[model samples]
Each structure stands twice: as C-alpha cells, then as structure tokens.
Target: MLLKYKYKLKPHKSQSVIISNWLEIARKQYNYRLAERLNWFEATRTPVNACPLNVSVVPVEGIYQNIPEFR
Candidate 1:
C-alpha cells in the first residue's frame, strides 16, 4: 500500500511570480513532449485498410530500409 500527501503553499509576491513562471515553463515543456510523442506515433502507424499495402514495397535506398542508424 502507498500513502500520498498534499500541502498548501503560501509564498511572498516575488516568490509567487517565480513559481508561476516555473509552472508555465513546465506546462509548455509537457505540451511539446506530448505533441512530439503523438506525431511519432501517428507517423509510425499504418492504416488497417490501406489498399495495395502502400506502406510496403520500398526501394533499397528508401527511408524504411533496414538502416543501422534508424534503430
């Protein structure tokens, strides 16, 4: 079992402003990471009903080729 605790914070005006700025930076970083992860997921996924199996049949020099750097 695990126990969690929460505490309220009371800060001076300057401290409050600094904390707010830090929170904003964190929020932006979180949003950027989320979008990057979503884009990577979408790019790597193939449609289930794609015709002619379009994702396959790549040339030897194509991006999908078995390159060591890609891994």
Candidate 2:
C-alpha cells in the first residue's frame, strides 16, 4: 500500500539553507555507512539482505530536539 501526507513549512532563507545542508550530510552519512557495512558483510561472506542501514527509522525521535520549547 502507498501512504501519503502533506504539511506546510514556513522556513526562512537561512533556515532553508541549513535544512538543505543537513539533508546532504544525512545522505552522505547513510551512503558511507552502507558501504562500510557491505564491505564487512563481504569479508564475512554474509548475506546482502542483512543490511538495515537503509531501513526505516521507526524509533526516530524529533530531529530538532535542541530547539527551545515554545512558550
């Protein structure tokens, strides 16, 4: 099944830049982690299906936790 959702974002120019940078960082990190895991799996002759680095983030908390609480 396909899931769909929508929301509004009101980020300013600087905030948008920061968000873009963060997305790039996250992508690079995930790719590097996946590559390292794949190498290890190959060395041990393990199955490729064992990789979970590209899996879902069901237990993910808020990404902006450091932001101060709004009054």
- Model 2 residue runs over 4 Å out of place are 1-6, 46-71
**Top candidate (lDDT):** 1
What tens digits encode model 2's per-residue C-alpha lDDT throughout 1-71?
99999999999999999999999999999999999988876666636687656544343556556678789
TM-score, one value per model: 0.57, 0.53
> Which candidate number would show the highest TM-score if scored against the true structure?
1
Cα lDDT of candidate 1 equals: 0.81
So what's the TM-score on candidate 2? 0.53
Clashing pairs in 2: none
For model 2, what is the error of residue 59's alpha carbon versus the real structure, in angstroms, after optimal superposition? 28
Q: In model 1, what are the clashing residue pairs, if there are any? A: none
